[model samples]
Each structure stands twice: as C-alpha cells, then as structure tokens.
Target: MGLSWQQGPLGAKAVGQFLTPEPFPERLLFVEPLRRRMRVRLDGQWVADSEDVVLLHEPGRYPVAYFPREDVTGLDEESRTTNHRDLGATAWFTVLEKKHAAWQHTDLPDHAKVLEGRVAFAWRAMDAFYEEDDRIVGHAADPYHRNDIRRTSRHLVVRDGTRTIANTKRPLVLYESGFAPRWYVPRADIDTAALKHVEGETFCPYKGLASYYDIGERKRAAWSYPQAWPEVAAISGWVSFEPDVVDVFLDGRKLVLEPGQGVVSHGIDRGLDPDELQERK
Candidate 1:
C-alpha cells in the first residue's frame, strides 16, 4: 500500500485521517508525474517508451502509468468507449491487433487536463514493463511502498485450541507500508503434523505467491510464501498464521487483530491472471 492503494492516505480505509474542516470526496483521484523511464514491450516490439510519464492514483486501485501520446506508437483508432466514474468517457485503443489494450480519457474536464494527451496500456495486455532493466511484476512499483524484514528474538507462538502448533524465540517481523507488522515463524519451530495443506492460493506483488495450510478444523489458518521475491526472500517457506483464525502470542502476550487491522486479500493487481505469474523473480 502506497499513497492511494490499501490503507494509504488516499485509500477508502486510510490508517490515518485528514484533519480538515471540509469533508473529503467519497472518491479521490490524484495524478502526478512518474519521473522514471518506463518502457512497454509486446510481441517483441516496443509499444511505448517514455521518460516523462504520469501516474494516476485512485482509492483501492494500483497506480496506473500514463505515457504522453507522442511517445507511444502502433495504436489504432478507438475501438470501444467506456466511462470512468470521475474521469468521464474513456477511449480504448488497440495495438497490433490486441483489442482494447490501451485507454485514454479523451473527454476529461478542465480539472483533469493533466491527463488529456496521455494513454495508459493495460499491464496484463503487454509482454512486459520495464523500469530500466528491472521488470516490474504484479503492478507498477508504488514509489512510496516499502517492505522490510527484521529478525527478532520475541517469544512468538501459535496455538490451535489447547495445542501449541508453533513456538519460537527467533522470528522475522515483516514491516510493510500502511499494514500491520507480520510475524513469520521458522519451519523447524512448527509442528508439521498440525498443518493440513489447503487448496487455492494468493499472490502478493511484493512477496510473490503464497500457499495456505489449514490447521486442525480451522481453514487457512496459516500461509507461507515459499518462493518469495528476492527483496523479501528471508521468509521463504516460513509460516505466518492468521491471528483472527488461530490464537497467536508474542512475548508471552496474546496478539489480537484489532479493529481495521484486517485487509482485503491482495490477489495480485489489475486482475492479472494467475497463470501469467508462474515465473516471477
């Protein structure tokens, strides 16, 4: 979560409130410059490349990068029309026979003129998006987003009813932007018998894919990112329990999920198909 998505200041459930007299809009949209060189590739062809890009941030949505029309190429005439609740009529464009692969808000009001001459390509429609040599996965990188892991000696414990499923003195605490710190336990500290592999999975843009496990009668009581992204590779194969599902303790104190702490499952961004994400680095 950064700036707009999830629990950021512009998100619907912001962790902190704006101390203003006037009520904020029910839905807020922010447009700002993306000062990095962004390039798009499709079918071994360069579709768009721009150093002067703009990013649109709306509540509950990943930031969308818009490139200046002059920097883009191979876009055909508008193939379809749609409406953005705040941005008005939007024109969808096809590139290299990829129908409706890009869009531009052609009928923007004066307030949103900053995006008048720009178009944004659908992330999943393109072959790959690059910020220099690094291929960005899941979604565009939120500049304000951060993920940090810290090793701690806190007495972390997980329980299913009266049985202690996991107990550890050394655990890794993952601190992410605008989210609660998650504690990951070592695999050796957990009782392997207590975990029953569950069907289905989820993905994190920052942490790669997650596999779930059901403990006893509880469904999806624990999860682990077996092949986490290199940035957060320390917790690979380590398990993190759902506090609201099973009892968790840290430093001899019960860890209860407080109000507003729970978040909607982050199942990748921009409706990316799970099959397109198997080779994440």
Candidate 2:
C-alpha cells in the first residue's frame, strides 16, 4: 500500500508514531482478516497452515500474513527480543533447526488485540509461501498496490551516452503505486545488437521475473518482462530503461529521473561495493 504508517486504524496507537504530538499526521497500518487458506513451507515441509489468517499492510512495506499459533507446528522458542512495535514484546522461534525462522507477539496493545498469539514468518528465511496452490513470489502482495498499463503514441528513445539504444513511436506506460511512470518500448524498435543479456534476474509480486540487458559497461541499463504476470501482460517482452543509468527522451523532450525512481537492490546484492556490479557480469 502507498499509505503512510499513521493512516491506518492502529496508526495512532503505534508506539513510535503515537509518541509524536497531536494533531497527529495520518499514517496507515491496515490489518484485515484473510479468509483464504495460507500455508508456509520450510525445507520442503509444511510448517504452518491456516484458514484464518490476518494480513497487515504498512506504508512502504510489503503485506505480511499472520497465522494463529494453534495452526502452526514444529517451532522451538529461540529467544525473546524487545519489540519496538506497538505490538508488545516478541518471542523468536526456530523451525527445523533454522535460526530465527519465525516470531510472534508475546503481548499486544488493546488496539492490536486481533494479532495476539499470531505468528509471522520471515519470508526470505522460509523455503516457500503459498496462498492456495500457487507459490507467491517476491514479497507478499500489497492489496492496495496496483499496476496499470496504457498505450501511448508518444515517441520515446533511450540512449547510453551518445549511443542510441532504443527508439519507438508506440510506447506502453505503466503506472504503479508508489513508483514513477515507466515507459516500455517495443522490442522491435530497440537496437537488439547493442543489448547484452545479463546473468541475474529480479522478481516482482505484481509482475513476473524480469531479465536485464547490459548497455556496454552500464549494467542493468534496461530490463524486460519476458513472462509477465497476467495482470501486466501488456508489458511482456517490452524493454524499459533505468532512467538513472541511461538517457530517456519522450516526445522530443529529455526525461529526468523523478523522486523514488531508484531501485533498492536487495538480497545478495545489498551492502556490496558499487564495483561489484562489474563482477556480477
């Protein structure tokens, strides 16, 4: 969700934000009862399964699913950690000898009473997470986050310094929540010879896996959704450039990287030296 943390029902009661003086700015923290069957797997074994799950949506954060403790199994208490969250102290747990595999709120504020005794698993620590039969990718889907693709006739062009990499008259513009507009150019219009397929890939919950293209020395200058999720199938095989890495022009005007356009590198790429981009090649 694009909402701020203080805009939701428990916003005012959250420990960190609540301490601020009134008139408190509206933040958001949406907690909704999920009726669908949810399951968590670790090392190819089901660790938690529940029909009654709660989904928490915090601004700028991915949705997290909380399952009732009774439905979960095979967890051993590891240690207790003082929670800075409004939801009391936290008790950490390990699954199948995995370290810090999960945690639950030991105590909760009255406003967050619904989350009492519910456990939230670390998605990255677990082998897989499922809503029903299909595996959920990336982070949990944000119910409030949405993506829209619109066909546009505006001329678009991408360049790596003086080398023109792509040019197109028909472009697809994707409008996604909490992100700036991304223009996708037709593959036929791109200089295919200049694109070098990169080794790494990224995933999106709304969209499917993305393949990157290296423009000479500039790594990941452009990317394409080879097999996009059904919701955003229109952008499948269409190339989109990273505005911060390359020059993009629309309708004869040069485009500038707007605020929030930077992609936060995560996983193994996080905290590495900037020069590591060359090693990834």
Candidate 3:
C-alpha cells in the first residue's frame, strides 16, 4: 500500500508544530553537510544516513531521525518494509533490534575508551549505536513567537549567612523545555571575587554564545550563554555547572547531576523541575 496525506486539524497542527518560517541560522546550515557523513554501522550494516533522514522531537521523546530504506544497507530483506512517507520523497525504515548484533558488542570499537571518563552514549535499543559525529539538530517552528512568550525570570543575590546579601532582578531567563532551564542571575548579583575565572566555552545554535566561571570553591562556576534569541537579547541566564566539578544551589539547596544524565553529554535522562527552578525562573 502507498502513503497518503490528509489535511484538517492534524495537518494544521503538524504545520504549526514543524513549519515555522524563522530564518535558518547560518550555524544550522553549516552543520547540515557534516550530518550526511555521520552514520552508525550496526551488524556490519549502516543505518540512518544523516543525509536523508527526518528529524523529529517532542516533549518527552528523544530526537528521532527516520532514515530512508536505501540508506540502511544490511538487514534481511524479509523484515525490511516501508512504513510511511513524507513531503521530501523519503521513506521510513522499520527494522527490529534483535535482528542486528555486531553493533551491540560491548567492545565493538576500542577507540571508545578515548571517551571513557568524559562522555557516554545511551543506546536503549540493541544493536543501536550512533557514530561519533552524529549530531542531529532540531528547529523549533511555531506560529506563536515562541521566544517572546516571556517564560523566565532572573535574579542576582549574594548569600550571607542564611541571608541574601545584595540582590537585583533581571528579566533574563533561559527556559528550553526539553533541555535544562538556565536561570541567568545578573552580573552584579554575583561575587566576582568568590568566582575563580576559568577558560571554558561552548556553543548552541538556538542560543547565541556562552562563557563560564568557577564559583566559590566550585571547579566550574556560573555560565552565561550570553547572546540569546533576537527579541530577548537582554536575557543572560545561568545554565547548570560542570557535573561533579561543582555543586549548584538554588534557594540554599544544592543541585545534583548524575552520571549519564547530561543533556549534551550522555543524551539520555533529563532532570525534572526542582522547586528551585520554579522560584528562580
């Protein structure tokens, strides 16, 4: 049977959810070519070539990159079947995890040790593993100026023996639902003397730029992914600190990050809302 397209509430919702006309940021376009070269070899077969995959995301779903059947080379012909189709003339591949194994071996790649202490990839599926450079990007497309909804609140205050020392309210909040929400405290609220300056930086296509500082005795300090969305450039928020390197506290309580739980690192598990997040954001 062939695929079909029906329009109504379903189509309208799909369009609203995935068809925003926001300008394609230059960084996003640059990463596209790299994606095609990124692929995973499972059971001696390559699956999900980034060149022709449909990336999807939702509230509680890991990003899904549906690949074309032709892109997946290996797997028995009997089980390889067409599931659905999309606007880009791409067909989705439906394969069983049990039918593949070579990629599931614990020691399939020895060079993996290079990432031993630093990063971990969570593969919930058997024979499922993503190649080293498999970075998939998702674009947020909605009719409502999602960025201007005004969902975050920021504060800067000094902790003084159970009392707030100096405090200021800044209307900057870094709230991205699927990812952790970073509450950016104002620069004035922080005790720069207590913060040991460090040289650390990271990038995000959605967010502009970022810089880090170590707080008190914490190895890694408050980070500000400074350049924010266009309409909310004034928002400078504090994203979480380096795991194990520092203990983050909101409202006097400490923030904890478990192994393999980082959004950018292991790519599995996310932190639920802490009462601190609600108060600070």
Q: Considering every candidate listed, which one attains the maximal TM-score?
A: 1
| lDDT measured at residue 106 in model 3 versus the true structure, 0 to 100 | 22
lDDT digits (tens) for residues 173-267 of candidate 2: 99876666899988899999988999887645567667898889888888998868788989989999987788899988888777544454344
> Where in model 2 is the C-alpha error above 4 Å?
1-28, 266-281
lDDT of 3 at 129: 40
Query: How do the residues 127-218 of candidate 3 rate in per-residue lDDT, one tens digit apiece?
Result: 33443443222221211112322444344344433543234454344444233334455556655565555775544434444567766555
Order of candidate numbers by TM-score, starting with the best? 1, 2, 3
Pairs of residues at least 3 apart in sequence or in different chains that clash in candidate 2: 4-28, 5-27, 5-28, 6-27, 6-28, 7-27, 7-28, 8-27, 8-28
State the lDDT of candidate 1 residue by residue for 223-247, as single tens digits. Answer: 9988888889999999999888999
The CA lDDT at 13 in model 1 is 88
Which segments of model 1 are wrong by more than 4 Å?
A: 259-280
Lowest lDDT block of 10, candidate 2: 1-10
Per-candidate alpha-carbon RMSD to the true structure: 2.7, 6.7, 15.6
Selected candidate, larger TM-score, 1 vs 3: 1
Report the number of the highest-lDDT candidate. Answer: 1
lDDT of each: 0.87, 0.75, 0.36
Q: Indicate whether candidate 1 or candidate 2 has the larger TM-score.
A: 1
